[model samples]
Target chain A: MNTQVLSGKPLAALIQQRAQDEARVLENSGRHPVLAVVVATDDESTLWYVRSIERAAERLGIGCRIVDLGSEATEQVLASVLRDLSAEPSVNGIILQTPLPVGVKADSLVGLIAPEKDIDGANPLSLGRLAVGQHAFAPATAQAVVELLDHFDVPVAGRNVTVVGRSAVVGKPLALLLLERDATVTICHSKSGPLERHTQPADVVVVAAGRTGLLKGSHLSPETVVVDVGTNVLPDGSLVGDVDEASVTGVAAGLTPVPGGVGSVTTALLLLHTVEAARQQEPAQLAAAASAARI
Target chain B: MNTQVLSGKPLAALIQQRAQDEARVLENSGRHPVLAVVVATDDESTLWYVRSIERAAERLGIGCRIVDLGSEATEQVLASVLRDLSAEPSVNGIILQTPLPVGVKADSLVGLIAPEKDIDGANPLSLGRLAVGQHAFAPATAQAVVELLDHFDVPVAGRNVTVVGRSAVVGKPLALLLLERDATVTICHSKSGPLERHTQPADVVVVAAGRTGLLKGSHLSPETVVVDVGTNVLPDGSLVGDVDEASVTGVAAGLTPVPGGVGSVTTALLLLHTVEAARQQEPAQLAAAASAARI
Candidate 1:
């Protein structure tokens, strides 16, 4: 098939080691990186995801705190808790876990996180900065896709990339990131007709549509590079990606597999972002101290 | 040919009248809507644009204040003036004129304006909100394009739209706006190969590339709807658009002319946005007052 499998495990381990090294330096400076994840649901999968994140962060020498706002918590309570965490100097990163309490949308509350502490790029301001080509933390999953391509030395600039999803957290932001890198990006969604028409001509295609088996062999060109961001659970309790890997394995030049791609790298990036947030706060604290001393 | 000229004059007048009506309501409520435009250079064209805005705003019974920072004004001076204007409660809208002095990029300084007071959508936060489909003031020029299309009853939902530029003010934001209306949009720029490859299949094409005569008749399929946003100055000092009007007249079903198309409509929308900002602020101010009474 000549298809190279892009595994996130090796990259995740490499990034985790780097994050651990950085965390040690911050600890030596008497500062510890902490990520506060707010969970507002009782869903098993959501809780499982939270625990995995905690374990991953701890492995990287970063502290992960889970603030479970019980299923009955109102939006106001959640907002207040987020505000308190945002104000705490020890909290380097803040993330609101998904499956938020009923009638309470995450979008309305994510803006409360201090932008610098929004390590996951959940804040609209971060996405906005990315769109305008300014300095801001990109959402980890989107950044992971780019990191995977870069690690493999794939050329992006001046290349055609068709992203087959348009969610703000993934597809839209990813398109902007690619655009900033000087790649010609086309964002297609459910409304975009004839998926093959868009994907066939692209040098690289990113499939983030939640639907499993959305991209078949017919949708890709012989040498197309594919990144599958979908992690759909099959009826048998196993995971299948958006692309039917069996069908496209022979057609595509490079592909990121379902289990060993995107998700693992996303976790590693979150820890790295936590460490990064802690590092950025050092200078700001020093500046504040300097101003106080002058007074 | 059956070429239909989509003049902005009729639309501008209609919107201007609506703006004037709204301005009277705000004035009657003891809150006169005001727009403060900050000019930082002595370029004749820039000054001419400022005067045009001032006259348009006044015609709509909106107060216009020109804050001239002079040609020698530094970035610090420009930022300070914009901050002051933003903080003024009566100044419902704040706009920064183009041709900023050397070393002062507009993007870097526009963030100083408060989002609520940024009627011209200079702030990145507003654009970010728009990206996420949240309520935020869109850039006047971008909104004008959509407003013109809607006024003519050109359906956008499920239509294929090709936007020929990616500037934050026009092309990029317009693409996002069109996306919000359920149109499948492809944003093409200098790097995108063969303009016709993108435009020919699009039900509508919006040309915003500043290059004169960028889109000719050859670029179109029969009966394509074209919106020309270019305002390039010809060698003879006359203004033209990105499209070659003579070449496309016979081939296109609808087209917007250069000098009288987007520019005039953009001016009217700026005033309309000023009124909208004033209207939005009233409720927030009332809430603050009501809370203060309880305190």
Candidate 2:
């Protein structure tokens, strides 16, 4: 059986080019799009991820502000920072990064993010808006999965798509996105009994469980298109997905590689979302800029 | 197979009693819980439903203010009315009745009902908050389904629960509530192909499709528990649910009767939610009232 690799690089590049073009247009209009990433942790991987976002933003000509409050940041401090960022007209998007300090609850702080500036859709308002079929930026990772599926020409409408994990960032949001697309979405979590029961009958299986090798060939049918959204670091300092790549390679009709799949597209989408936010926030500014350019 | 009837009357009575007790206490303390019902249209059924709510509120000693904007109300009028009700210090709960005027979209007006006053959970923010497992009121009908299941001693944890219909008010919200209780929920809609494919294997099936007899005997396994949320009115002025009760009675393990099931509990829950919202909104007011009464 020939296995198809649903790579995210081509899609990510396409999105990145679009973001770059939009960012340049906004910049020419004297309205530079900026993404404010609020980080309260000193975790190595988290810092690495933030740096990658900065590099990506730089490449796209979008301003990336890394508001590192350090490891000892309190929830009060975090909340205040988010509130200020939300009110900051210069900041087009706001992302409260994970792995907060000991007492800082993400749920408590996420609400402080203004919905217009919520590029990653961390705000509950964004989630609710998405669920009710309203226009809101979905979580970048969740939206990336949908974008990847579209890129691969995989039809989600009327298809059985099983989403593994129930995290707010990925699974839950992804399920809402799929449901909007008219897909029969089943969300499986730790409490959900065997993974195979849900995955085997699915037309497309999305693994975002974060546990390495959580999904294998045995869990899916030969016709299943598997999307691995997990990026787990192995003991050998290598990144792998929730799916056991070797086991599901030929058995599954199609599979998305971890590092080169959802992750790449997520970063690209964040930049695009920032650009979009900028455009939405200052449409009059863009119009004025366009008129000035004509003059 | 002899099937058990899951009656919501007992649970509705319990909730009503609780709401009455709370309302009495709140009223004594100078903070009377008031639910404002904003009606826009002359839809007979919608008005009847609103009147029933008013009667229920009266019976519970909770204040029900019917703010009828009449049939010719514009979206602007509806939005302003909702905003005024939301801002009214005496108003603890707000419900915008459906079958609104021709051009008035419920979605646009629902957001105007502040989350604190959104007893019915019509606000997208409320839904979003519920989705993230945050502190928010679940839509009463959705919450009623869970409460009824609990009263009947139906365990949803780690069970296969298929929800038919994907409306924001009932099916979607109910699915989220069930998911929170650790049920592996599958939301089946019109696009989900054949309904039996999703329903027949479920440990529990909740039908909220608004289509009479949407689920029949063949749509379920013998061991399945069914909760009918539909309230379709027949041409003869008879009320029926989405489930064909006669067809499913002997086949399913348990079934909730149409009029005596989710509807009764939903009204009771709405009143309860209003009292609870009142308590939450004016803790200081209640505290002050308690002190005054003590004096």
Clashing pairs in 1: none
Chain A only: TM-score per candidate: 0.95, 0.94
How does candidate 2 fare on TM-score? 0.95
Per-residue error (Å), model 2, residue A77: 1.6
Best by TM-score: 2
Q: lDDT per residue, candidate 1, A32-92, as tens digits? A: 9999999989988789989999998887789999999878889999998988887777788
Alpha-carbon error at A92 in model 2, in Å?
Answer: 0.4
Instruction: Compose the digit string of candidate 1's lDDT tens values, residues B167-215.
Output: 8888778877887887777778888878888789788999998999999
lDDT score of residue B51 within candidate 2: 94
Across B150-223, the per-residue lDDT of candidate 2 in tens digits comes to: 99899999989999988999988888898899999898899999888999879999999999989999988998
Model 2 preserves the real interface contacts to a fraction of 0.72
TM-score of each: 0.94, 0.95
Docking class of 2: medium
